[model samples]
Target: MTTIKLHNTKTRKREDFNPIDDKNVRMYVCGPTVYDRAHLGNARPVIVFDVLNRLLRHVYGEDHVTYVRNFTDVDDKINARAAESGRSIGDITAETTQWFLDDMAAVGALEPDHMPRATAYILQMVEMIEGLIAKGHAYAADEHVLFAVESYKEYGALSGRSIDDMIAGARVEVAPYKRNPMDFVLWKPSDDATPGWDSPWGRGRPGWHIECSAMADELLWKEPLRQDRLSEGAKSQPHVFDIHGGGLDLQFPHHEDEIAQSCCANGTDEMARYWLHNEMLQVEGKKMSKSLGNFFTVRDLLDQGVPGEVIRFVMLSTHYRKPMDWTEKKRDEAEKTLRKWLDLTRDLQPSDPTTFAPDQKLLDAVADDLNTHLALTYLNALTAQPQKLLDHARWLGFLGDKARQDDEKARSAYTTSMGSGASDALASLANRLDELRQTAMQSKDFSQVDAFKTALLAAGVEVRMSKTGVDLQPASNFDLAKLDALK
Candidate 1:
């Protein structure tokens, strides 16, 4: 059994992962609020978790792992969008959800096993809220049900904040009805204009935190939640899940609140045994914000002609623990590298798909806390063996069967453009650069070497030189006519 080490935010250490049930390994990652197209920052966790999901499927059989990423359809933002667009709430959510799917799929992410919507589990949310109230962990005031943060003594354990500090620094809703400033809403009354469901309190809907707790409980928990608050043997029930994850931003109030309500309602000590969070993302060394004019949706980049594979490559080049910066330079380098690899492994397929396994070192890198940057290093090493590199890259979701079909078409076009004369011209240019280097080494005043290199770049031909020789390669937009002018 290969040991998997993950940094658990709950324990604050990279501990060995021991599944509660190996036969049914489960994970739940916080998903998007479907009010708009997912931005680049939003795509980070999707890609990060998708890699984890793939790694899990490889380690544990594909049938053994169950990954659930939920959709937040019932949000104030969704409702506001509905009101502003003058469209029905259902229409807005439905359209936005499909847009999110299309954009995430474009980024080489495999869909999770479950994508639950908040609206579909209203009954479960109400049941869990009522159970929390029955356990005295929550109370209703001013037609809004609020969870009593004081009731959960380990309230700040995950976020590592003292209650006094939380009360002072937290930007909580200062409603007169709340018992404590940190007390968060479990359910809030909805007006006739807003989306609502009939509840014991009034026409209302579940709060943001409660929706996830309820959904995860119903879908991923090993056992149904213990509804009866006074059952003696209830605490021993198997309500715990394997892993819970999301962006680091959700660590404080959102995830903290989920833990409180879930433990209280289910009569368990823990909701999830392990917690993980990927760091945020940025654009060009600055925070990705709309005001900065850098915040762009995933679709926007795709529309701008950046291949989805390039985006994924640039993203995975950095570990998920560090903040990722999206830059055109990174995209260009990623595209050039992918093109080179595809050219090396073009039209190659596994002789036997059943026996084709990912390279062990590549899998080991992924298993060790999802060190994707290290996995890429291993991938670079395999470039010498095209067949092995092709097999491994496929497991990492690059140059798969479909991508190879496209690669063949592009290779044919590239071959047609670079005939015998063109190849002869490229070799001649390489020899010229090599001769220039040798002359420069002796004269120490060969301005001609720099001049020729500048001219080659102007003609859009990438040039490389070493002690032995020089190499020249063409970019996607390489101009042969410009190269002929240089010649």
Candidate 2:
């Protein structure tokens, strides 16, 4: 068995992963809050944990690994969007949820075993909040149930911050009723205008932190192995999941509050054994912001005709712990590499991941703290063996028979409309692009190559370059007449 190692944010160390039950490996990554389209930043944890899920399934049989990613359907953002758009909250949530699904699928993320909607788990969340109040871990004040952060001595353990520090640095809701400055809401009352469910406290909605804790308990945790079976040592069953992951930004209040709520409510010492947090993402070397004119949703990139595979490649090119900078130059290089890999393995067919043996080094790279960047390096090394490359790419969710079929359909359409001459023209342009690059390489100047690249792009050609050479692929918007300028 390949031993897996992961960096645990809670412990702040890279440690060997030992699942409590080898037959079942469970992971929960926080999913999108479906108020709007999932932006590029939202895709980082999705891809990071998607890779982790794949690795888990590869190790523990596909059926044994259960991955849960939830949808935060009920949020202030959703309510505001509904109000601003003058649409019903339910309708907006449903539409945004589907959009999130479609956008993630384009980026090659697998649907998790359980994609629980926060609204669907409201009852469970309510029950958990009630339990917290009963246990003196929470209290109801001002029609809101707030977790007593001071009640849990280890409240800031996961984030490594003292209560005083958090109180000073935190953007705490300045509520007159909160017992302490750092106390967080477990449930809050909702007016007739806001989405609410009847509960022991009042007509209220679950706070963000309680939703995930309850959902994980329902979906991932085993039901205490039946009381009768506990005599056989089942009482020692793990309290929660093997791994919990999200962006670093969540590490402070959201995750810390979850730890306090779950541990205090359940009488357990831990919530998740390993906590993994991926770093934030940037665009064009600066924070992605609408003010910066760099804000882009995943759908926006897809609409720009950047393939999901290329986006994923650019994402995984950097380690999860390192802040990823999304740059056009990197996108171009990633597209170029994928073009070569797809072309190299075009004749081959994708198969079941189990049917083909992945390169040992590739597997090793993945196991070593999910060194995905190193794994990509290993994937790059497998180019000479098309069969090996195609199978491995399929295992990684890149190239598959469906992708080929789609390409073939496009190729067929092109051949039918443009005739056979179009094929020769593309090859000629590819050769021309390569000749320009080779001459520029010797001259220590890439002015001509950049000029040709710009023109080819204008004509809807996706230019790819590797040490082997340049590969020119016609994009969906290819214009045959525009190539005459380059000629």
Candidate 3:
């Protein structure tokens, strides 16, 4: 087994990854706010970290990995959207969250093991706030409770900036009740329009940053006192997780604040052992924004006929930690590459079971904190050699027919234009195709078997049966260049 390494935000260095519990690996990634349609920029972290989660499960047993991603359904942004749309916040959040899940699924993002919502964890947030107040790390003033920035000595450790520097850099809001310029809200009183809950302080709502910390601790942490001793003799040992990931934009205020709240409340130096942040996706080297008219939603891209896999491949083409520039040409190139891999594996016989030697260099690149750019380069080099391309693609989870169709249309336009030699080539192609179809039939892969037969027939190949199996040959002459054009 290969050792995976990750860049830990806390230490600001690439380090070998070792899970807290060898049997159970835990991870939590911050999820969407659910105020509006998720833009392509937002999808970067979702897909990038999803791949990380997939890799972790592959490395460890599937059942051993616990990946938690939460939703901020009760935020100011959501409240504002609800007010503007003339709908209740609950309805708005619910609709947006559903849409987000659908879009993420389209892009091949795996659902997290746990999808905790902020509204569902209000009690947990209130309890954590109470604990902070009891511990003297928080103070209530004018019906608002604020976390005392001076109390947490390591507040700026993750972001690598001094408290004074952060204060100066931040556009700190001047509130009369706040003790320090850097003190942030834990809970603030809400009015008739905003959602509120009865707490020790008053009728208020949980602050945005505090929601993630409490939700993570609730879902991922197990305290002995909270365990039921009657049903279970003794509390199970705590399973410390491996990773916490999000976008780079969260590094300063969001992630930094989460670290402060969780560590200070739990009385532990380590909340999550390793923190990972993916770089943002930009358009023409500028931050994508609606105001600039450059923002693109995932649905928009899909509606434009850009395949989900192509979008995913483009996202993975760059290092997860480096900014990716989205361009039409990039997507075109991704589509072309995906088509080549699909063609390479189209006639592959399952019985052959091509054994691919793991590309050590590619594995090393990915293992070293997910250097996807280098890994992609290695994959490209392997594809340049005809024999190893299909095998290499299988390891990358991009070789199967489903993965291919996810990008290219069912029948390529190029294949339709092939006039003369295409039919002749189909005869040779049919021989190899028949072998794969028979293997699929024997394995009871009815779907693949059906698809192979249909594709061959559509491409002017005729199949006939013999005692052993099926035999196929082309119907007439067709142009190969025209087929390439369709591709």
> If scored against the real structure, what TM-score would every candidate get?
0.89, 0.89, 0.79
Model 3: worst 10 consecutive residues (lDDT sum) = 226-235
Tens digit per residue, CA lDDT, model 1, 1-487: 5668889999999988887766677899999999998988888889889999988887778877889999999999998988898999999889989999988887788999999999999999999989989989999999999999999888889989988999899888899999999999989999988999999999998899998899888777633432332133323446778899999989988899899999989888889999999998888999989899998998999898777777888899998888998898999888877877787787576546455678678878998998999998888888779988887877787776655666677656867977776677778998988888898889997799999988887776777665568988765666778777667
What lDDT does model 3 reach?
A: 0.77
lDDT of 3 by residue, 1-487 (tens): 7799998988989899987765567789999999889999888998888778766776776767778899999888988888888998989988999999988877778789889999888998898888888998999999999999899998888899998998889998799999999889999999988999989988889899999898887777663422322122112333234688999999989988888888778887767889999988888778888899998899999898777777888998888888999988898778767766665556553223343345678677778788777777787876546556766655554554556554244445444565546655655555656676678668877675576666655654455555565655433322244333222
Error of 2 at 302 (Å): 0.6
In model 1, what lDDT does residue 439 have?
A: 88
Q: What is the per-residue lDDT of model 2 for residues 110-173, given as tens digits with 9 covering 90 to 100?
A: 8898899999889889888888989998999989999999899998999999999998887888
lDDT scores in order: 0.84, 0.85, 0.77
CA shift of 121, model 2, Å: 1.4
Q: Name the top lDDT candidate.
A: 2
| Alpha-carbon lDDT of model 1 | 0.84
Off by over 4 Å in 3: 223-240, 347-362, 382-409, 412-487
Worst 10 residues of 1 by lDDT: 225-234
Q: Residue 83 lDDT in model 1?
A: 89
The true-versus-predicted C-alpha distance at residue 21 of model 2, in Å, is 1.0
